[model samples]
Target: MELSPVLLYGEAEGMVRSLQSFPLRDTGSGGWLKQHEYIEKLNMQAILNASAGQEEMIKDLLVTHGKVSSLIRELITVEIWKQKVFPVISQLQDFQPRSTFPLYMVIHHEATIINLLETILYHKDVCESAEDLVLDLIDYCHRKLTLLLSRCSAGEIAGQDRLLPSSASETSSLEELKLQAESLEFDVALKCLSVLRYITDHTDSLPLSITTRLLNTHNLPCVLVELLHSCPWSRRSKGQLQKFESGRWLSVPAEDQQKMTKLDGQVWISLYNLLLRPECQQKYNIDGFTRALISSHRDPHRSAAEPSGATAISQLFVSERTGAPKEGADLRAGSRSLGLHYQREFWEMEGDSEAPGEACVLPQ
Candidate 1:
């Protein structure tokens, strides 16, 4: 039976109240399994509502309960699990399972929550509701983007051309499962890109710490310039260009080859947001390296009417090159060190807690 709006809201409320972190070892425990199932169903419903232009009660409920922080905490927790625990499990000689589906689901939990957040966080209120946890979410995005850049730089991301396996039966060996997990990681990183863009959208109203993190601590503008160069989402195979879209890659026709994909727009818009905002401009210290990076992408032929097009970016680059440094000038190197101190203090408060003692078993 289809879940009614009332039932969905009830489920959302229950999920909010029950939200808590699970240790890496207890990822597939009964309670965590139940929450995972709930998230999957809610994610579908949220997408459906978004497509149909209906009310987003799930977003409303989450905001009402002020559980956005809890949701972000869960996202970070599962990400930690994927990074720390999944590898050990993959290598365990005696850890054979009846199926790898449960393990895959645990690894997939990060993607699910991020997708749901992407759906709901389009609203300004939802962004506001994230409160202090927004800092944690920024840290998470930094980690994902940094890893993505390294993979792209080493050409590791493009080498994994295979799509995720269709079923658990196809992932028979642990090594096969490991490959699938790596593929999923690429998708998760792309999703993080969209999430980071949304966070940038709200920087005007967000705390100053957000702008500081994006500009000084993370130096995301430079990172984004590198992404534009790598173009990880678009790659060549057999001399045919393919672009990732709607969860799978499709070959680009010759006519559409020059067109910007959604990923391209995301990166450009994020740059626009970070560079054009007055507060961001004040905080962002554009040295010679950043100026050259931005100038390298300048296009004099781009239409000025286009939103966040090459023209706007080029103008910004020229201004930075000629404009005097802002008052209270401090080197980014100092800001980075200060930002690290703040990051360490923030995470130390999160504390490491263990799961309740129980046998590790597949969720059923």
Candidate 2:
């Protein structure tokens, strides 16, 4: 059912005003569950408005209420929950629930917020509205893309699992729920790729801190190189090639095997935005390792010919680094330390009580 206009405004206002951190132990609590339902509705409204080319009142309400930073915080909050808390709950001996729907909703909340931001952030105003929290959002995206790279490297991302159980019988065990969460994470990482690209689109207009964090602080160019090498979104199974598109993996025909998926385009576009910009080039230090990585992709002997996108990226990398400073401060270690700090902070907040019971049930 669609939300009425009056109810929509009330939900948007409540979501903005009630934004605060909820501990991992408080997952599925009454208050947190209420926010979950409200966000789900807002996500739907945002999508519908965008698809119909209508005025996005929900987006307006959110920006006008100054809730963009809150949304970013909530995104990171659930991300920490998924990384630190969900596994513990899944392994508890006495923590069985009647159904896994409520827990699934909690896990799905991260996707909802990122999805909403992806739709609205297309407008420059939303990016500006994100303000200083843009750094946190960048960190959140870095965590996801790095996870995607690691999974692809381990060959664990080749399987194409359904994000939700098709039948009631499938949700009976914690193992099945864990698998669903993994599949959902694959999609979430892909969405973050899109969000990062949008942020790259507005680098000139955004704060200098963003450009510094993406280039020097996080070294996303090397991360993206690894991603291009691993290519997580496509894999071969039983001698048939499959590529992930529109939330599912579909078999690709021989004629279309070489076509780049949207996922690939997102990576390529973000690379261009980061590597080709004059401001980013002056700040980015292209060391020997990064130079070699880019050069390898452009090698003619690697394949019969490189993709046009790869050609463009390598050209940009070569041209930008000419006569540029080779030595700069390496913040990779500092970034890792900061990540550890977040993990410790979240782990220390674990409540002694058991996980919350199902407060709001999701209809099948």
Give the best candidate by TM-score.
1
Instruction: List model 1 lDDT by residue over 111-158, tens digit each.
Output: 899998988876778889998888888889889878988988786855
lDDT of 2 by residue, 257-358 (tens): 866566766676567667766578678877877767765654221245523344445544564355332321122223223223322332233221322112
> What's each prediction's clash count?
0, 0
lDDT of 1 at 69: 80
Candidate 1: list runs displaced more than 4 Å: 1-7, 159-172, 298-364
User: What C-alpha lDDT do the candidate models reach, one value each?
Assistant: 0.71, 0.72
Clashing pairs in 1: none
Candidate 2 off by > 4 Å? 1-25, 163-172, 298-308, 320-364
TM-score of 2: 0.79
lDDT of 2: 0.72
Model 1 vs. true fold: TM: 0.80
